[model samples]
Target chain A: MPLPPSPPRLSIGAVAGKTVPRLADLPWLIGYAAAFAAAHQAAAGWGGQGFYSLLYPAAGVRLALLWSRGPRLTLAVMATELIVQTIAGIIVPGQAGWLTAANGVARPALTYGIVVWLVRHVAARSQSSLGVAPMPLGLAAVTAPVAATMAALPWTLFSPELTGVSGLRQTVASLTGFVVGDLLGVLLIAPPLLWVVHAWQYRPRALHRPTLRQLAGLAEAAVVLGAAIAASTLLAEIGLGVPAAPALLAVAWIGLRFGRTAGWCAIVIVAAIVLPFTATDLPVAERLALHMSLASIVVVGYLAGSFADAQARAQSDLSRRDRMLFQAERLKTLRAMSVAVIHEISQPLSTLAIEAKHLHEITVAADPDIAQTAALIDRKAAALSTLVRRLRRFGGRSVDEPSALPLSALVETVTALTRAEARAARVVVEVSPIDPDLVVFGQEIELAQAVVNLVRNAVQACDGRVALSAHQNDDRVVVMVANRCPDRREARPGMGVGALVARAIVEAHGGTVERVTHADGTICATLSLPRPGAET
Target chain B: MTLPANQPDRAAVYVVDDDHDLGAAVARLLCRHGHAAEPFLDPVMLLSVYAEAPALCIVTDIMMGDLDGFGFADRVRMIDPAVAIVFMTAWPTTANAVDSVRRYGGLDYLEKPLDETRLLSAVDEGVAWSRRQRSIRARTAALSARERQVFDLLVQGHSNKAVADILGLSPKTVEDHRAAIVAKTGTNGLAQLIALAR
Candidate 1:
């Protein structure tokens, strides 16, 4: 399965957590809220309920993406939510003391727990599906719901007059509302928030954009926000009551189009503009209480959003570290294999030196067949030169960049390059029939290096005979390097040099590798890679 | 084969290096100067043929695989201790230089890529030194112990008093030993005495 997309930058905040002092966090939160409020006001009045709802879910997913931190960060977010809510209540003062001050604080704290729990659940499911360990899934699930429920308590208690209806009616309505809001928030806001966190952390080139793309995306978001506000205003003027649903739809649409921050900004703007109109119909105390409660909800949502973002970022970082560790281990194995290659090649070089000296002596004693001996010397020298070049290339020197290379040409080059070394070692190399037109995408030097490594390994593995072959089947080009196993006692552990380097090269080109050991004590390493211009 | 003393042939020099082009070029330069020179790419082959030959001088590289210049020079010195040795190396180190002088008695070290002028000059100096050593051996063969000591001091540019002090003798006695050295070599004056020492 393809790997999940990386999280975005805002999500990384979950990992940094309180590492960023409250003094710094507070201003950013305030700015985010103000932007959110303005966007909400503009979009909800201009756009319909569908747009607002769409915006909320999108914003919620974005926030969820950002919540990368573990339980500790969730708590911090809860605190931030409470603080922001309290401040907004104080500033608006449109509700009763108990409803506005106490209820406002309680609602956000509860929301924080629910959001954290749901995020942990989703992240667990994702990990299990990906076949990796699910990190702290159960912990998040249990703690999140409980924390969110507890945080919501003060709201129910402070506003008992309005919400404390007879029987189970009030309880059911409250529970339903809480579940729907939290679920919507987690699903819609969390994913985008996580994406942002991942993007910021890893900063993959594919996700990067030029200034023009960024500007275009931003401009589109502004237009969407304006439409949301117009819709919200029209709905309210027609005595359709407070257009909360329409305003939410507008937020969702913006979220989908422009991401979380934009969606949340639209939500806040709609709230600011609509809340004042709704407040005018109520008594001073009720108005104050209502205004404060709404503001508190906004603040709570922001904190929860940020907390989710940070957690996602932390998880991504952990995965990235794991990948790096795996790569390092692979490199170490390659280095160990190179030692064997050195041993195999050094013997040939020593023998060649001895033979050259003998040839020189014989030539001086009797100049008979001088031209033939001279040609032989030149040929041997050229072979030794090629061997040295291969060794140097394997030693990690900067070589020519990868380019489009034909499979047949690459095999021919490697065979020619290693012929002298193989001959000195008393091994024979045979090539299998292959398609001349079959081309593989990669640098010729790298492909040659891979082929050379494989041929050398095969020769070393076999007693005296090895075969190098290639074929094309469907979209994949298959190259097989086979050697008769040296006695069973000599069969080294793990993958041999040829198989390892060949596998590395093939995989780097988005291919698969396999090894087969025949019943007759012969080993074959096959590299299957996608042909150039073939759909993978 | 030993050459007759009356012959007018100039002494020959040999150069050995893995680089055939450079070695051949050097040989041509020596030939141009009226000296016979042979270049070899393999030091082992060069050593097997030239070990006993009385060459005026030899030039070789220090980094060859089978027999490096120093090893070849050691073999040459074993065969004939009087032949002059000049070493050429791509990488010159202090230890190798000192070792070359100590082990093979090489006259000088040259770094490659060699300048033609420098190589020729070094070859000339080495040949001249070898010729001087040959003449000294021929002249010193018949000197008595006392005369040999005085002759050595005179070649060192010492005065009569310094020679007497070194030999633990009076100035008159050292003068008598110097007179005997001049008579034994059959030279006329101090300049001729020094030339005879050479």
Candidate 2:
């Protein structure tokens, strides 16, 4: 024979809205009731006496069966209870026993049926609230008392011995208990569990460590949290008479601060405080309404907080994208610069290598004095090699790190190094007087690289005359490299390697760089850096 | 030091370039090797020098401000039909090589930064070819007008009958002219006659 087909699975949201329950829903109800019974036993002493002792177990079973499935599972549970009582009576063999068992089974079956009706009604109302149409708080308030009165009907109608007691009093007590229990279940248990499961499904792992700046942002967030809570609390006290406004404020603050986890903790604490007091006098309908209201607030706050967090994360991503683009552009400029440098330097280096080799051979075979001359030539070649290495490092890939560097000394050194190149190309390089003690914070290698690029570009731009000058204005130090290119038209601003790199370096150091073409056709690159100890 | 008497018929090596340093360097190297090398900074100067004496081999830079190496070689070939040309460039490419072959009669192309060893070797090869061409010219110059015409006809692969019809003479007269051409060229067979034509 073929195996029986399994029942269809329904999502939690579907369970909340479905009109009829499936066969599998009955076992789920039993499990829910058993769990509630265990929770009640753990809370109150398990050995407690009297009918009140049974109340916790009975309420647990009722709530578990109520929320686990629809009216169909509830009706099955009621029938199961009746069957159990009838079986006990059959075993006992007495008229009084059978009559008492029948009465007991009948009463509970009636009460269970009422609970099923109440749960379905409330679930319908909650579904409507989730839709585009707004849920009326007035309708919920009225439903709480009505559902409570229905729950109490079986007890009142079956016990005729207590005829003098008003039905209204019993109805009120039953309604209060039902409403309180329902509110407690939703507010204390629902949102946090949903949030945990949602978080697990969506964001399962942390990708990055918090940087120093991000840690500082977290500190700022704490201050903002405190302020938002105070503001929300004041608004809640003025609007709603609930004494727990401050506590609700605290929950909202934590949600906005550390996010969803802390928010749920705050919700639980507030619910535990409010549930007992609100449940005491009111009918079941009013109590349930109160719980639903509180739950709604927590859910809305959590969602809003998550949205704000996502926006902040997106902004951070944009900043990182911009930084990458800037780095890529800088790299492209460096490549072009290296190519130009290679083309310019190759001829000189080749000539020096060949001449040195020839001189070495002649000295080895001829005069002793020529040996000293060859040694000097070798030293010059070594110096050129060192210069080439420096140029390569300047153009090569490296991370940026800040250190104290003597600005004037760096400028002077680059000028001296490029002097020979300038002379060979028949161009003049002049360095103006600068303060000896001026120290700027930057990556020394990068700063030197940028300055070299600018000077080289300026030399290439001018025919022969180029001036490098430095001046201090208040808290800023400005270095200007100007070249006279009278016949040449204005070149595109950021064309060469040095100008592009100079801008990157200066900006990296929290400074500014500007290129100005004068009326006299002299192109000037001005680099302005903050004076030592000056605020950026 | 005794100088050789002016051999007016001796072929001269031509050096044409825009770079003063490179042209002078090549001229000095050529002089050391006992070859007459004239250096010109411009194609116009090279043309002027060629008016005095036809060059044995022309070495020129491909890139110049005016009259690039290819155009100069073409003009030189127009003036003197027998001069051989070689090209030097910083950019060596197959297209340039093909172009040099097509336009300038298949001259050797050298890439710069020019290796001195390769430059000298190419120059020597060009000079040796020029010497062989000079010798051929000397032999050709010794032939009488009628003998030269008969030799040209034989080199064209015209049989005695075809040669007699084209020359408007009898086949016997054509045969007589062919025998004389064989004697003057010092060739024993028709294959040797083709070798002499080359």
True interface contacts retained by model 2:
0.00
In candidate 1, how many Å is residue A37 off? 6.8
Q: A1-536, model 2: which lDDT tens digit per residue?
A: 11111233557765544534556565655555455445545433211111112113344344334433334455555555555445534324366445544554445435544554554455444423221111222222233333544654565567533322346654444444344343334334534444443465457577688899767856665555455455655765798544334445555565666544445555555555554655365544454455545645554444434444544544554575567669878987978777466434633553454355446656875677888889678567656745654554455323324656777888877887788878987998988778877777777767777777778877877879889887877888788889987442323333444565678788887788777766445778888888778884
Poorest 10 consecutive residues by lDDT, candidate 2 chain A: A46-55
RMSD of 1: 22.8
Which sections of candidate 2 miss by over 4 Å?
A1-331, A345-365, A368-536, B1-17, B44-49, B70-75, B91-108, B134-169, B179-192
**Model 1 over residues B1-198: C-alpha lDDT tens digits?**
233334568668887878676677567656655567888889778767874567888888787788778778878877767788888765444567777888778877764434445666777788888887777677677898888888888888999999999989999998888887777777777888877655
Tell how far residue A432 is off in model 2, in angstroms.
67
Docking class of 1: incorrect
Which residues of candidate 1, in runs, are more than 4 Å off? A1-27, A35-84, A87-180, A190-536, B1-7, B17-29, B39-52, B61-65, B87-118, B148-171, B184-198
Write the residue-wise lDDT of candidate 1 on A1-536 in tens digits.
Answer: 12122332334555455334445445545544554444334423222211121122323421342245433334444455455545645324545554445544445444554555466546545643222222232234223434554565554656555444333444434543443333334443454455565577557778455599878877776676677567766875898644444445545555545533554565566556645553244543333333333433343333343344445545665576566668869986886677445544543443354345345545665666884686588467546645654564455332334556778888889889999999998998988777888888876766777778777877766889988888888888888888887433323333243455566776787887665666455777777888778883
Model 2 TM-score, all chains together: 0.44
TM-score of each: 0.40, 0.44
